[model samples]
Target: MVRCSSLLVALCLVDTVTPWAPHAAQRWARHSARSANPQDVETARSADIVAVAESFGVDVNSRNKACCPFHDERTPSFTLNPDKGLYKCFGCGAGGDVIKLYRELANATFAEAVEALVKEDRPKTRRVAEVKEVDASERIQLKQANAVAQEVYAEALRHQTSGGARQYLRKRGINPKTAAAFGLGFARPGTARSLTKDMDKSAFVAAGVLYQDGRARFGSKVTFPIRDACGDTLGFGSRALKIRKDEAKYVNSPASAVFSKGSCLFGLDVAKDAIHATDEALLVEGYFDVLALHDAGCANAVGVLGVGVTPRQLETAARFSPSRRVVLALDADAAGDAAVRRLCDDVLPTLADESGVDVVVMRWPDGAKDAADFVAGRREQGETDAAIASAVRDLCAAATAWNDVDVCDIPINEADAASSSSSAPPDDPPPDDSQDELRKKIDELQKQLAELSAQVASS
Candidate 1:
């Protein structure tokens, strides 16, 4: 019995250290918890200890002593060692690596904390004049500033006076519960500048919440909180409730230390679990599309923050979707088609070669503008929930793989127009073809074919 117990203990230790142990899945929940991936764990552990501490607002002086966050203490007891990538507090007897420091300070699960650290957009070593690089300490402060701003915006939306924002959401078919779940908010005029009045102006400015001149980036817009998979509020994506003649209809917070348009995916915080569960990711272009798909029960949807999906965004998606399947459900307009063509011609091929992931593009329902519209149309036609899911699945199933999709094909709009014209009835009746007319038409076709063959042979 003693020998058997010792052997069991040894086996458990080995299992804990193994890379992606098979039992990891059974050990954690999909959404709230993460399976321990050894590579990710090592990456998180290797981060700078002092920098990680500083990210949580821990001030370490020359001696690396700070007040303990875990226990009440008047004197400094928490100590961080950068060289060893570890931290300890004598007062509370707490100790661990940088990952533990982050997990505690961020109030995150071990997996969530690791994900956050690994996914952090670490600034490059080389300095670029145009883009400001934020150190660990400053980055935390910026994130804190964003958190406060998001709260302010959310509170503004909940206010009785913010009916216009609520009305806009209603028009979009977004219920109150869904809006609240997504952290949708509003930034009233003058509220932006006022909200930063009591906060750190420089931090807010660096966070892209306030302009350098102290003006707010969003005003009278329905704000969407853009967060990472770990639920850290990075920035805001806002749509104007009432578009000003000179102002754009939509605006995103400017690139900052915590937020980059190319790297962030809208609704990722909410959709990552579904992506992991399905082992697939549904990529869309608009924020509304993400919301719509999630509401329709297709929760694996995420939206690109910019005009098109970037490699950084794809990399992040691939991390969650272990099966490495991505379905493109971008808009069905001419611009959307052009973007798809560009991806097929340039981006998807290279990504396929490197990652060996299967990517496909979805075919839109007739006359639908985007995913949101497509879902809305189905609902309007009285489709049941399961029926809608089936329809969506069918469309995905019918999509062609990226490599097989022909980029040389004309745009959807052009093809639609051509089809419409060819099938429509002619205004005048066709005249009978004479023998000479038939022969002449055949001869012209033969001449064109011969010319194409000659050019092909020459080339």
Candidate 2:
């Protein structure tokens, strides 16, 4: 819980939430009428007392008396345990952690308050701009539609405990609890052909979670819910269920009103706090990669949902990373290679001019396919979280950008090209670091083989 709290606080510490001040009294009466979970209520309070107090207007930071948020007071009587994230106010005897504060302030039930705290990274206002503004009513309707879709998918996964989705998660080192925490689901083939069979066709389609073409787009796959920075359920990313040649390995909800792949980074809603706290954003290649790395103790990791890192996504990352430092960790395969090249050749140049955060590429360890595989193998080797984190930090430290190696984009204009042709090298340019390293490895292998042959001849 402390780990979750600290991670959350980094992104959302001072972000304003809904203006509940006016309706706080009414909400409290309603919340008190409902039953609540005692454990959840306690856990939320324990995560970050300072954040909770500050959010509710408590001047917990003052050495002098500060006004109590719970009651009208000019001077503060709040005692705090900074290490423990707990607080007690001497005035009005109002004392508790953030959960208690929320329960009091929002007049929210224990569960609702805890859930909101858990979603602390979500921004208070995240209405994205488009060509035409989305009206308030349309936004509410889309939100409701996606909410139902997420419920449907999650329920399917829950029932499929003995199903392939469970097996895939186990193989990937994701437990059911972690899956639930991330809102993972199974687009079960065992269920109806289309998840939205009973859902509103128009609304679900508009939300990009459904299609009326009589085909289930994400059928029989593990669903990773994609949300905006404000925690609105936008759409989903799904990986193939049964490994097959014909089916594409991965798929995502198409571009719709709620979801725009180019503008969205998976896990932003959850990891924004950690990103802001660390002043660094970790960009990965896919949803599982983000989850796997986070589960491996790197809380700031996010993914592009199989898309290349776009300028809009980088800008979004920059918002969370005030220091403007980001590390792009892609897979060790060809697609990953191309993605990194494009990032360096395209996005890097544009980003460089901004004088904002610097971007670095995290090269995979030898033979490591992707981040998820790397972390899983590290765990298999009995590596501690500290060791894995250290390794990640070291890899990031060694990061060398394409620009650092003097890689530059050539102008396509006739005049620029004619002038630069003489200076530009041939198509077979000198090998980069990766190529040079491979050559060295091949030379070493050849030498070892020759040595083995000599020994055999003597024998």
Candidate 3:
């Protein structure tokens, strides 16, 4: 009977028609043809082959002994056949090719897994059949631009007279050591044109240091140089020193060949070691919040420029600590509540299900807007280091246990009188007051009679 019902349901589903059904059928035919050709499959497979074993921090060439993701096993049962780009776990019987491994690891569908692999495997540059060699003079010019920008930014910071840039760092809880380690600096007003005189002004304009209206805008703001893991400066993030209420607070370099906002966390390069050592990360919404956390001796903190959390950021955070546990400290507004809900519902579940990362939501105190504000308010009150640390830890603990169902289960906005009356259990006795009173009087005599009957029965 169950089988018959299932068949009926399937037939019903097939009978429901859509206008795009014909187009979907055509696309499926093309996809089938692509999958059927063994030669094409082999070429595409080889060209984009990914060794899941190696990708998961394992040595592909070594014996099949590594830490398993399925269970807590010290001995490696996960075997990688790099020759075929396939992996199997003998212990847990988990097996798959590259795409399957990603699906299993990320808890995503086949299409999502394919998309993840495509993003990971795409080459940085397009392939050229014949590569042109750069001459010595051309190489020297490229090197010169790189070297001069570093020196100019460094010099600008060292010369404290350069428009209160050093003072800004001091005010933001960034000590001298941290600032120098991150190569934090101010861009001199005329320096962009001077440094890139030989190069095109378009490059500086693209880097967000100068305006395209033929004016250098560095002197108008304090700049922080953003770098890659290799310590090469990719772009600049500028905070307006003084601005009208209508002006933007922070401006970043536009997307260029080098700097991709989606792939960069503001302070991850500096904070990576600390994050790995602690096995945790505190994700704040601003650069100063990260700085404050580090200064407060909680060094495992990093902030993304935007509110949107991307897959690349998650992957990068996971690379730092495979068991990534993040505490999100966003603002305390309607937007913040919505952001937290989205993270709990969508982002964290996907990460937890696939990558085994744990995520927690930290709520700021009422009227304390964001991380920076919280830290500043505590500092003003001369709060002890221990007190501050304990507060943050408590927030993290609360966030770790946050559940959407629990939040939505209780109606918070309704009146107490209405809610209490509505939720109270029904009375067991009938509504007739005379019957209820008569029953109560009768119950006393019945209890006495029952006691007497028990004695008589015993006799």
Q: Go through the candidates in order and give each one's C-alpha lDDT.
A: 0.73, 0.66, 0.60
User: Which 10-residue span in candidate 2 carries the lowest summed lDDT?
Assistant: 405-414
How much lDDT does candidate 2 score? 0.66
Q: What TM-score would every model get versus the actual structure?
A: 0.64, 0.58, 0.59
Ranking by TM-score: 1, 3, 2
Residue range 201-308, candidate 2, lDDT tens digits: 777667666666635667778888887766777778888877797778888888765577887788887888888787788888888788887777777888887747
Candidate 2 residue-wise lDDT at 208: 64
Model 2 pairs in collision: 11-273, 28-107, 65-76, 66-76, 324-357
Model 3 clash pairs?
66-76, 106-354
Q: After superposing candidate 2, which stretches have Cα over 4 Å from the reference?
A: 1-134, 160-162, 190-199, 213-215, 405-459
* Model 3 misplacement above 4 A: 1-97, 100-110, 114-151, 197-208, 211-214, 244-246, 384-387, 401-459
Order of candidate numbers by lDDT, starting with the best: 1, 2, 3
Candidate 1 lDDT tens digits, 351-388: 56434557888867756778888888888999975787
Clashes of 3: 2
Per-residue C-alpha lDDT of model 3 across residues 153-212, encoded as one tens digit per residue: 677778756747777778876788877766666666667666666677655565555577
Per-candidate clashes, comma-separated:
0, 5, 2
